[model samples]
Target: MTIEPYQWAVRCPETEAKLAIRGLSKTFGTGAEAVHALVPLDLMVADGDFLCVVGPSGCGKTTLLNLVAGFETPSTGTVRLDGKDISGPGAERGVVFQQGALFNWMNVLENVAFGPRACGESKALAHRKALATLDMVGLKDFALKYPYQLSGGMQQRVGIARALTNDPQVLLMDEPFAALDQQTRETLLAEIRQLWQRTGKTILWITHSIEEALFLATHIVVMSPRPGRVRAAFRSRFNESKDPLITVAPDFVEAKRQIIHLLGQDANKEEV
Candidate 1:
């Protein structure tokens, strides 16, 4: 589809390649009773890129993610993965939700193996691969631990491991750290940074914090509240060093401030 000049969809070259979302819109109910949760949304996430999307509460940010995850469909527009229209969740797009989503009865190894087994992988091979993935996340020692036995951060790590075990090209996260305390959040942020650097999988993260978006993403897309629309986006060039601590640097703070100011601008316009 031909997105208009400078529209959110047309602006991202990444969307031109791997993943393209054009004039994406979603609504609930019908007629005057219907709520337009999102309107003509647009986004393009490139291969091997990290994109973070932030917006006020109830802005349909998760709705957009759900559409791509194939949990729901857009009322208008299209979401395409590699030029093919998205039908449903596939091995290519791995999702890590806010809730660990881990099977309580299963240990780390079992949880990671679930994806491969569902794909028809042999139990032996799947277990072996799962073990390797657990090691990759430095959770091999806790392979036998159930979700209940692990800390919130550890549980989230296992969630990440399970998604990675399938070797997905695109990793979509929905604020996986929202439940954790500050220190734990910071630690996982660093760990996730290293994981992204080592794995090189493109990530599209949904968050509400300007600081988190500026810290973790190479590109940050900020949306306005209710009937969410793309208010602004920024290319956060906070070095390619892969150090999470650099988020405290001057450049990082400035980028975050600018984005926050932009987000506030929309709130102001809406209030007026």
Candidate 2:
């Protein structure tokens, strides 16, 4: 299979973007002690786009996600969701962390229902929505179980179901499957892709696994090491394939190889 060239220019006009980042940068501390976590970067995620970010450690992938999620203020630049500036965390954006951040005291159903409940929905309505969302993640039967009772994979499913219950316009995930075993991670990857297809929600995912990004993202962004910047971006076709073994296809392998090469270069830069 012939490989298509990577698209280095992935930016789109703000008018057409579902999530837009412009000249975004973040710095911690001050003066000589200051740490530059992210450099000025611009990205545009269109509606229903699955955009995955990959890079070497300390490349500010999580920093960028936090900024977009409104968990932290940027040193400069702006993040706009649906043309409105994100002042802070809002219902329109739902975040999933690497570990399942469910409340241990709450059962799976209550944990998933908490978001809607916080938003002032009646308990009856919230429980109904939570049950429906749990069903979507194949965890309806586990509703009465507490986080401690479920396996790690099942807990993560609860995290995902919680995020979906609110019906957010954008989903922000920070290496959400990093803690899972390979088999479980792969299972969730396929499930999440199907979920995305079914919901048509825009997603911004950060993952260190190139295979995960290739298999799940419609667009991939590679960031350079520390003071992270967009080193390269590509529109991937592998995500469109339904075959489980597509990862081994020549073109898929080639695409992965190319990203590995880019990341290798970024590593070399960090060492120098």
Q: What is candidate 1's lDDT per residue for 181-255, written digit by digit as tens?
A: 999998888788778888888898999888777667777778888898887776665536555467677666666
Q: On a 0 to 100 scale, what is the lDDT of residue 187 in model 2? A: 92
Q: Provide the overall lDDT of each model, using Cα atoms, as 2-decimal numbers.
A: 0.83, 0.91
Number of the predicted model whose TM-score against the real structure is largest: 2
Q: What is candidate 1's TM-score against the reference?
A: 0.92
Candidate 2 whole-model C-alpha lDDT, 0 to 1: 0.91
TM-score of each: 0.92, 0.97
